[model samples]
Target chain A: MTSSDALAGHTFEELSDYLDRDRTPADPSIEGSPECQTALNGMQRLRSVHRDLLLKDAQRESEREDSWVSSILQHISLEARAGRDIPISHSSPTARLSVTEGAVRGILRAAGDSVPNIIVGRCHLDGDVTEPGAPITVRVDATVLEGEIIASLADQLREALYAALRQHTELAVEAIDITIRDLYQPFVPPAKASSDE
Target chain B: MSDAPSPDPVSTDPGTSSTLPDRLDKVVLAVPGVDELYSAAPLVAAVVKTVIATTVEAVTGEQKSNSSVSVDEKKAGLEIAVKIGVNAPYTAIDVSRRVHDAITDQLEQNGNPDVAEIAVSVARID
Candidate 1:
């Protein structure tokens, strides 16, 4: 560091971690620092948002259709947006076999998310998704739960995606490129063995 | 008209006005090609639906639908606006028409007539 990087030699996470250890007897260093105060405020906002989400989850879970309700509204909205029309083999001019880029994206995202402990950070259908019979590449940056081997997890995700595409879409999936963006651990992972192998 | 406080139009009594958004939220959510709800705030729910739900979806990025549903009670009728995220390959006009029908039919079923107009805004394609 630079002055912009830290508040008197402490990062935001450091300040937050310090408070996390104890919230009752406030730490003088953090309380006295403006940057720490700002970080605390940010954490407070995040906590409130998290609480709100839990409440919403409760409401949604109480009714089985609450999740469906979310999907339907999103479907309607997505069906209306403009993008390249991925063609499917349709005989009639009036009849169209086309999927929206957004729809493809949504499908890919869902598939990625379907894998246990997988969350997609970024997704793209690289290549003209609208072109039927054209080889298309799907790229996704994803985060996986820690302690799981990355290669195995990625392979599983890839298989799931390929299966979903085969079932739900007409696009020719040439490749699915998964980049492991981060390791997600709700808590810290155990340190690796100190073997020299 | 069966003036039973107009089915709690924009007030405390839980009836048509209170549940219209909830009804819309269900039906509209069932429509295909949806991604998220737009502009709905979190923790604000009905017995006073539309306003809170529609507004809050915009606030919290978590558990949001690509479509937003709003019901405004007016002297003329119920003014409804839905902001939606559409699938790029689909036609906005067709999808919006479907959304309009869904909202209208829902309102009518909830004992609400006199729908002033439904304004469908295409917020984005996600």
Candidate 2:
């Protein structure tokens, strides 16, 4: 893609750096661009939870695969754009209300992340999200922390996603399909492991 | 007192008060669920405008108000557009509707006649 297409003309690296700086000196270019702002929001959420997710594995940082993080970052960049305007009906003829597709995806990610032991990797809206009352199926890719029952976690995530979507938009949601792509085990202390064994 | 009555003093100058767009911005942010206000203008246009404004401010020492809310005067009425982020636990759609109603109320209170449309979109839901 050309220069203009990259996260509202700012690279993901630049965004990460900006966040690293705690958004000090307030760069108007990034702040003014909605796409950059959206991505930044996602990045901030991920960063906030990163420590908690890895607290048990602090000593095994090197063993953690960077691929999942890359995958989620890629998805964030793609989904942080204003793709389509899904209308919100208002009784007044003059009032036109709606939510952006990018915003919907943000909620999906948040909902999935809310579930314990699950991190949303990528999200997709499979159907005409722009069309009102269209049959839409939400497909989400996730990575779950090992030791949690996969089936139970998936069910909990599905319910959370459904609730978030129903609350935020008027889309006719047919189903929520969740895929657990990877499972990573947290580092357990030797003493704890021996005691459990 | 003199027999001649003093003419009615002007209560307040509309020009001195905050502009309609500014007022609407405040109103939207004041809504319980709104977390952020994003530029409603398209990305390309917003970038160009920011560049120009930044340059102009640096050279001329004059600050320009870069309001996220877009207002247009039309034959039918005024058209207002805005994009906002809704804080969690507050439904995005509900927040958007509240913002829409808030804008309409602001215009009505200001004695502005008719609203062509008020498009409020939730750009981010935290």
Candidate 3:
């Protein structure tokens, strides 16, 4: 069979074997020669470009400098201005339902998961500590949480906070309190936006 | 104008002190491609500022910072220049692309874009 015919329906390995073993057809022609060379070159170029694109994507992801913190803060401020009391709870000595900056941050970090583009704001937890298993409320100021994802975030934060508090201190892990104070629309700044646009 | 000692300016002046560097550090760290943003001497900052300024002008339609870059014979690699400009965008893609294009173009034009794998990052302003 001709080289092109032989290459047809053959995998790369088969082609490589045919080429490497010098197994040319009985009637040799330029088709057998340059065709193999061209195919091999194409494969190599494809691999190189594939690798470069992957690297470039990763590099682009890493070089990004947008801030989730500011977005979270903005959301929180907006919510506060709207007269909605952002939910928050602490299992400390004082058990109340107000937000604190630190608690807000803790909830956010826990909820962020591996998702990119999510930013958490400073948490404010109000409530009594020293009470184990107290129903601690939770709140978050985030830019991107939708549908069931918000519930998932709440669950994740509850678990994470319980574990973190227990792991770090001897405080009895009480109930988790969750409150989403503000939500922000994800924004990629104008300069970067223009490039992608 | 009545001189009131300027009230010694509240500590929150984004300018004045070393705030820009701190801010840049936060910004740079937030970005993905930036390994780190180091504070350099005045001379180094000047060179970096120039490089950045020239780069932005060449690549982006707008000029954001007055920074530049210079090679440190002693240090071997390029030294970062400073003259913090807060107006510069903090996003990594915006800064990196402009810097990358400028550096690449300059290097290619000068016959060496391949050799200078310089990564430019605008981490902080101070």
Write model 1 residue lDDT over A1-197, tens digit each, in one string. Answer: 23345543555456556656765576544443322343353344333433443345446566755342233222322322224656544332222334445445555555565676665545567787766778889887776667888898899989987875674467788899999876644443458998996
**Residues A2-74, model 3: lDDT tens digits:** 2334322344455445544555662122122222333343333323433443244335555645444323323
Worst 10 residues of 3 chain B by lDDT: B80-89
Q: Alpha-carbon error at B110 in model 1, in Å?
A: 32
lDDT of 2 by residue, B95-126 (tens): 98899888878776776556788899888887
- Give the interface RMSD of each candidate: 15.9, 1.6, 25.7
B10-102, model 1: which lDDT tens digit per residue?
332253333556556677766665443453322123113444445676687433232236667787777766555556344444555566667
C-alpha positional error of residue A80 in candidate 2 after TM-score superposition, expressed in Å: 1.4
Per-residue lDDT value at A91 in model 1: 33
Chain B TM-score, one value per candidate, order as shown: 0.62, 0.79, 0.32
**Candidate 3: residue A53 lDDT (0-100):** 33
Model 2 Cα lDDT, one tens digit per residue, A11-66: 77788789889999898778766667778888788778875444444454468666
Model 3 residue A153 CA deviation (Å) reads 2.7
In terms of lDDT, the poorest run of 10 residues in model 1 chain A is A72-81
Which runs in model 1 stand beyond 4 Å of their true positions?
A1-82, A188-197, B1-126
Q: List, residue by residue over B2-98, the lDDT tens digit for candidate 3.
A: 7644321112223444222233334444444333333333333444565676888889866443312322322332222321111212332243443
Instruction: Using TM-score as the measure, name the better of candidate 1 and candidate 3.
Output: 1
TM-score of each: 0.37, 0.82, 0.24
